[model samples]
Target: MRLARTLRFDQSDENVFERAAQPDEWAVSGAFEFSNWSEDDLSGKRRQAFANGWLGLESFGRATFVATAKIEEQEYRALVERLAAHFVEAWGAPDLETARPVAEKELAFMAGLCDEHEPNTLLIVERSLVTSGVSESFRAIAPQEATLDLVAVHVTSDD
Candidate 1:
């Protein structure tokens, strides 16, 4: 029998999120930086993406490195579109051949840590981009309380 990972959230602490960000093995290439609260950014908006309570993927540049946090599917794709737009303006269309799978692998890594899949869950990627590239609407949601969003983040860098 296939046992689904428990996808419960700790109302007060980020430990649950921290554990969720990690899997037995990582699929993406690069060194994984696992921390209680690792720092990360999306474009110009910096946040505690790696902390026990955060969500989404912080992809810095193309094939550079990737960090992750949990996110909703809709929110996730929206961020990717933002990145795609950024890449299109800068270089003219993104080379998905290199982008899509990388994001998927990281997404799956986090998913595996969950007890069960939630419909609202997402696979968002926050590439290191200029804040302007991201729509103001995305930033409108201030005060990201951990309880409201069951997510976590992890950073990665090559030695």
Candidate 2:
């Protein structure tokens, strides 16, 4: 199976998100967090997050970029448990048993988003408040063949 993991090119996420997700943590669209929000509620970092954040499963934080990655079944199961627990604590789910299916569906949707892309392909989600509720759209950036090294470092010495 495949899912998205947070990627950090810089420290901007730390500045923009309430909590910045650590690089490589699992991520989902996480629009669920704003289920009850109104236009008046969209301001500041919350606005930034609503515009373009991927929710990290581990930290429950936000990330601006996420890359597709392979996931083992065991790890997927573990994520389900963690997310279900979160639903209980964060959303007041009746119990773990009731939250389990909801968590599974959330993860499954994330996995489906990765199904058509290759590993390391970056995915972005843009969300906007529609009349009924929030609407999400995804864009994918596939990795390209590099003609030269994408990064380089210079060393200086004084003698």
Candidate 3:
């Protein structure tokens, strides 16, 4: 039977690096916030000055996950769409033979966003797996400084 589980970061007492290295064994899936940044604007410059921070699942096996900020609502929506496509292309039915398309699409989508909001986002990437007699699970990683919280729910066949 498959089982689902959720783990909440003990905000009162936990470190991000340590958590990243070794999350709770019982946790199958989880999410958390990371970091932040700020910068001053320069009137004379042609570009806007900005700074930001982020935290999320870094690497899952050979795949590396990354996320950035979204300045406008339109951009945010586009980002979500792109992310979905990325997942589909990277690990969906009828999988592509190459990862180039997924990478290109993701980069192009990101290029359209504002630089100021790029650093303050979360990204998750993982490899595909199959389960039969065992159970299925999900895992999420995030930074502690991001100030975001996640609530995970576990599911089981008996439940």
Candidate 4:
């Protein structure tokens, strides 16, 4: 069964940077710094800064994954759009409509392959480095009808 896993912007703690540095097999690639949040114009803009920061980080991660993973471009772009929506939902944006243009542009680099399949599980990790806050969330969805099996097997078997 095909599944789509998306890491939406849920929340994060201050230790996000530290946690991101750890070796995670699930991670698609190494961490990279996001610089869009360094705008001097947003000094007193707390809410805007927070929103930009979240989106910036999410985009950074998504870009890394799209470049590294051998998935279809359309699938990656859709995932990016979903991520932007997730960011707006979590941060409470003043104008979600305006944000879509920027999100689309950000995802424009991915433009090909429309038959990519989604993953079985999507993991979301958010962190506020400036405030030292962290939030981790995840969601699993099946694309089609399916059944999950739960079985317990003894680690040690007795003859």
Candidate 5:
């Protein structure tokens, strides 16, 4: 199945996020984290995260970008289990049994987001507070040719 994983082009995320997700960690939209929050609740790094960060499933950290990638069934199930536990611990869900379905739905939505995008296409999420709740829109950045090769392979001598 296709899913999204954290992607980092530079170290700027370290300064922008409270905790920056390591590259390649699984990611989700994470809008649920702000379900009970308001404008006042977001400040500084927290606000940055709400603005344009993808939630890393493993670290509970934030990433500026995520790339569509493939995931196996076993890894997916483990992610479900981890997120279910997080719901219980972080959101006060009754238990894993109750949280499991909700966690699955979140991951399923994330997977669906990746369905149309090709593998390695980077995605960014922009979130805002709507009257009823949070609103999110996604933007996709297509991959480019390996430009790094020019710097690595073609060095010119000084004139």
Candidate 6:
């Protein structure tokens, strides 16, 4: 889902880097592509950002880090519409080709996924972000405002 969010950096602390790398409140509210990968990467998306930490699933051999930006709400609907079109034009969501008004359909698809994975928004971060040396590289120049397009699939208990 596309929602407005802000991740302010508190550079005052000695552990600012540590704080930036860790997931914030918005991370729990929705899944985010923290990386710069295309939304199509979501079909194979398996990693997510959470309040406590991250989650990953290796489904059908598709997974990657795709960071998400927190954006303003005014542009949210347009972005979703653009995303729907992006999938159809760039990624080729064949089924969406037939779904008149692709944006609404995309919204439903995302909403359904969100329903199943609420209270834990996904985040796409490179292994380097959460892994060793995270403190030095994860720092943000300023607070961000963007939407999160979550595509990571949560594995079942059996899986």
CA RMSD of each candidate after superposition: 17.9, 2.5, 19.5, 12.4, 2.5, 18.0
Q: Residues 7-117, candidate 1, lDDT per residue (tens digit)?
A: 223332232222233221111211123222222442111232221223312322112112223446675565445434434453344675455454545445444433143
How do the residues 36-84 of candidate 5 rate in per-residue lDDT, one tens digit apiece? 8898989999999999989998899999999999999999999999999
The residue-by-residue lDDT of candidate 4 on 12-40, one tens digit each, is: 42233222211211122111122333334
lDDT of each: 0.31, 0.94, 0.28, 0.33, 0.93, 0.33
lDDT comparing candidate 2 with the true structure: 0.94
Give per-residue lDDT, candidate 4, residue 100. Answer: 66
Measured by lDDT, the strongest candidate is 2
Residue-level lDDT of model 3, residues 73-149, one tens digit each, is 56434433444444455445244334345434443433433232334233332322223221222223433453333
- lDDT (tens digit, per residue) of candidate 6 on 31-130: 2223343333323112222212222111101112212334355554554555555446644567554433655554444344344432324433233234
lDDT of each residue in 92-134, candidate 2, tens digit only: 9999999999999999999999978999999999999998899
For model 1 the TM-score comes to 0.25
RMSD of candidate 3 to true structure, Å: 19.5
What value does the lDDT take at residue 75 in candidate 6? 54
Off by over 4 Å in 5: 145-159
Worst 10 residues of 2 by lDDT: 147-156
Which parts of model 2 are misplaced by more than 4 Å? 147-159
Those runs of model 1 whose alpha carbons end farther than 4 Å from true positions after fitting are: 1-47, 56-94, 116-159
Residue pairs with colliding backbones in model 5 are none
In model 4, how large is the Cα lDDT of residue 153? 42
